[model samples]
Target: MPLTPIKSDDPVHLAMQGLFPDYNPACLEPAQDLELLRGMLRPRSSGGVKGLVHRSFQGVTRRCPRPLRELLLGLAHRLRCADPELLKEPNQCEFNRLVAGVRSQGSRQRGYAGKRAALCLSYDVDLLSCYRFLPTLLDQLDQRGLKATFHLLTDWEYRLDPALVEEVSARGHEVGLHGASHDVALGYRRDERIAGELRRALRGLGKNVHSYRAPALCMTERLMARVRDLGFRIDSSLPMSSMFHPSTQSCFPYPLEPSGVLWELPILLQDSTLFLDLGLSQEQAWSFVETHLKQVLELGGVGVINLHPSWAAKYSGFHGRLLDAAREWSDFAVMTHKEVYNCCRWGGAAPSAPAC
Candidate 1:
């Protein structure tokens, strides 16, 4: 639907126009309004009062009369009032926009030119079974000269040999939060459980990380908001498409709503899909991954491949072949998860509400 313009003389509309200046009032929604103002407040996910965007709002105090800045801030508060949960914690929105700006730059550089895939071999280390294959999997990635994000669990953070976890990080691979538990049925309890899990994993992973792939890919808007409140810039939980083959690959890194954090990439062909879902053999699974890669390349989009540590163990040779194919054929950046997240976050021009 096309955007409808607000009446020029209304107080709220006028304030928005003056604040944004360059953005068309017709193009703005309540969510977009919140995002733009939030973007003006903070760039990094970290909390505190020193954000440049936050200071810019403060500049209104110096450049304009006192009453005017007060009026604008008041209006911003009202505009951001739609979600009480969101209004309560304003920092998440600003941090999301900051990350979005970073991502837009990376996307521009990639330029929709050739097939550039970002295969995320995310290991949701929330299960004992998943961790059983860590040594071999790490060695495999190392042998192939590839790096990936290990979305580790808080429970195992201290339990895992510190040397092993450090090896992944020190080798220039990324480490992401995979929540603290591996419950597959979090959809019902997500609202209550998400914050605690996210914060736990964040503190466990050290404070510098920004990306998270939900445990079991079980995510919802409410869960995403919780992740955002915990200050994550990228959520790698884009839904996998049902289609396959070269022409059918249709995954790309787009922003998710409620949080506005850039979804680094989508999970297109998961390694376990064949075993757990389709019952494909080793040869069949390899064919599927290769075909999906070709389709992603042909479409000039990012190719996101997901593999579990447990699945890699179950299908040993398949793991080696898939990585080999990715290295040889795919033109995608092959990012360590953090690099992909930092690259796409909102920053340059204000991003409107993401396409639902």
Candidate 2:
């Protein structure tokens, strides 16, 4: 698909306006804005005051007077939050006018072609143990005739079998690049270093890899641009919730303006955050997924779900139940990430085959 200028009232355009009321696409450089927002949203490690003080003072703070230590840590956090390097606001009035002009032109664009809602199953294979469950997972998906996209990590400690990767592609599923080594700090890397890492991972993955997801869903604008320049067709890294807070960005796929050529498949929900991070029970997590699926379908948007293979292996019963529910859902098309991106891009007919 070719990159085209987004119309003023496109959903993505409006969503961007809604997200950063002060955002001005024309006034601000895409890389600068994206980097600023990235730094603002990047997740922070959980640490207590003592932990912070120790790290900041290099272990000397632990021996300092308790009151002095507390004071130092408080000032440090306050200074960090007020850092000028982190805050940059774009022109909101111009952005609003831009989106309003587009909205005035026509209705917002729907994410899926033929106005059909879609459900995309995305798996991030981060560990070697995760690879062992692929056959079973593939068999289950094949039985249901549901397509999926697998994001493989190439630079991890263990090696991924190239033969297995080829087998996945042969089964009509999509294989996407995760990262070179699953680095959580990848978003903070310099542009040159980031490009080199991506190139290395792409080379390791062999040919025909067209999609990417940042490690831990942490991404910067430079990283995205490099990915596009590197020949990726889509990115599935943005999320509704980031390291700092939940975002108001749409959960549908949309063209990332400035970097207009690459499509973004924003994750609607993730199993790891829901189950492991948030401490939601398996039943509750699946229920949350079902709820979001129905809501997105009603709005005619795509719902991209992230499920790690290692977690699936551990919670096989829960994973199986979720897939079973997905197979039975008739309103949405269950497809791979690439299929959904293509359908949204070319405005093609909806899938005619029954989801089951």
Which structure among the candidates has the greatest lDDT?
Answer: 2
| Cα lDDT listed for each candidate | 0.53, 0.63
lDDT of 2 by residue, 245-277 (tens): 223244556656433346777777778666655
Give stretches of model 1 more than 4 Å off: 1-115, 156-158, 190-192, 242-250, 257-264, 346-356
Q: Give the TM-score of candidate 1.
A: 0.61
The 10-residue segment with the lowest total lDDT in model 1: 83-92
Q: Which stretches of candidate 2 lie over 4 Å from their true place?
A: 1-115, 242-248, 349-356
Instruction: Tell me the TM-score of model 2.
Output: 0.69
How well does candidate 1 score on lDDT at residue 63? 49
Ten-residue region with minimum lDDT total, candidate 2: 86-95
